[model samples]
Target: MEVRVLPGEHFYGFLRFYGKGITFPKGHVESGETYEQTALREVSEETGYKNLEIVKSLGVVTRPAIETDGTEVIKDIYLFLMKITGDDKGKAEEETEWLTIDDALTRLMPQEVEFLKKIQLEIYED
Candidate 1:
């Protein structure tokens, strides 16, 4: 479930295959480019939403993954909560829709579900 927020609300990406997933519009970090910069670029490319401000870092999670060819790799993912401006104008690259937090959570991966719960708790504390 790729989650994007607008002001007081959040939206999750709904793809047919993945169900709902919080995915970053991500790319390989270019030379000398910070992860944040790469994130912004990826968001625009994947979703066509360009107006964003970083709210906070959600830290990183590293996990082992296997490629289709059976190559093992360690995947490091950096996460953040971003506030988007304007209406939903981005062209979705998949069969996607904006979902409520509760609905999205039901479809997310287990780790992602836990992460979002923690993030929401932190937000309430703020």
Candidate 2:
């Protein structure tokens, strides 16, 4: 997920999946692409904001997930701290919204909420 501070508040970028609900932007890494590169591209594609810079690595989250075909798998999600670097905008390919920490905590999945809460203080200090 990406967070940016504007005036008095910090906002998180979230994508609304049609049947899956809201979550951060994520995608499979393309050939020859690093995890950071994939994150930057996916965020830009889903949020329509091209200007972003990675501030730091936020660690990783490994979880069990069921695929559309009912296959279960373990997924490793790499999290990063990123910030908006410019005002460039375009039409988003997916439904996207910028929400405050409190709103995001309520709307995100339990696992994700835990992750966010763990870094909440760090975000505030930035």
Candidate 3:
């Protein structure tokens, strides 16, 4: 996930084009790619952030959803808090934004919103 601290106090998340709401950089784990490598690649692909430093793994989150085939799908998402090394640059493949955490929450799906809040507490709260 790509996150930027706005003015050193507020947190901003990247909003993707197809994801319907504000989301961190994410993508499938390609064959021959480590999860960490995928995460780094996704961040760069979706948000144009190249120099990333993974702060820590926030672990995995799982949720159930129904696919178009009506099959129950259990999605496991690996969460990471990362910092970018240089000023954000490059053209993203999709529309992207660095929105404030509160604003991002407003644009997130219900389940994702809760997950983001948990991340916020874990990172920002004692």
Candidate 4:
């Protein structure tokens, strides 16, 4: 998810929409890259924010499906509770909308919010 945190007691998230289906700002963990590394790189590339920090790990999302060519593919994606620790220096295309944290609770799909909340609460923990 591409996010921006205002200097307030609270912050929000932004939605990255490509089409009818919303796409998350993430990528497969590359060779020699840890889960956090991949998350940082993906967020930076997708959102153009350079200073990103993995506040915590969210979890893993796996999709095992058969490719169109008949080969079976198992896609395992790692998720994280990442934060924007730098300036929002880059501008995104018009398709990108700030997915407000409050709105995220309501606008996001149930499973998506549930899936993310499981790991994101760490930011509020002691």
Best by TM-score: 2
The better-scoring model by TM-score among 1 and 4 is: 1
| Candidate 2 local distance difference test against the native | 0.80
Q: What are the candidates' C-alpha RMSDs?
A: 3.8, 2.1, 3.1, 4.1
lDDT of 2 by residue, 99-118 (tens): 88898888877788888889
Q: List the residue pairs that clash in candidate 3.
A: none
**Tens digits of per-residue lDDT for model 1, 67-96:** 779999978777766556656557756454
* TM-scores of all candidate predictions against the true structure: 0.69, 0.85, 0.76, 0.63
What C-alpha lDDT do the candidate models reach, one value each? Answer: 0.61, 0.80, 0.72, 0.60
Better model by lDDT, 1 or 2?
Answer: 2
Model 4 alpha-carbon miss at residue 72, Å: 7.6
Per lDDT, the best of the predicted structures is: 2
After the best TM-score superposition of candidate 2, give how far the Cα of residue 89 lies from its true spot, in angstroms: 1.7
Off by over 4 Å in 4: 1-15, 18-20, 63-74, 88-95, 105-111, 120-126
Q: Would you list the clashing residue pairs of candidate 4?
A: 13-99, 14-99, 15-99
Off by over 4 Å in 2: 1-6, 18-20
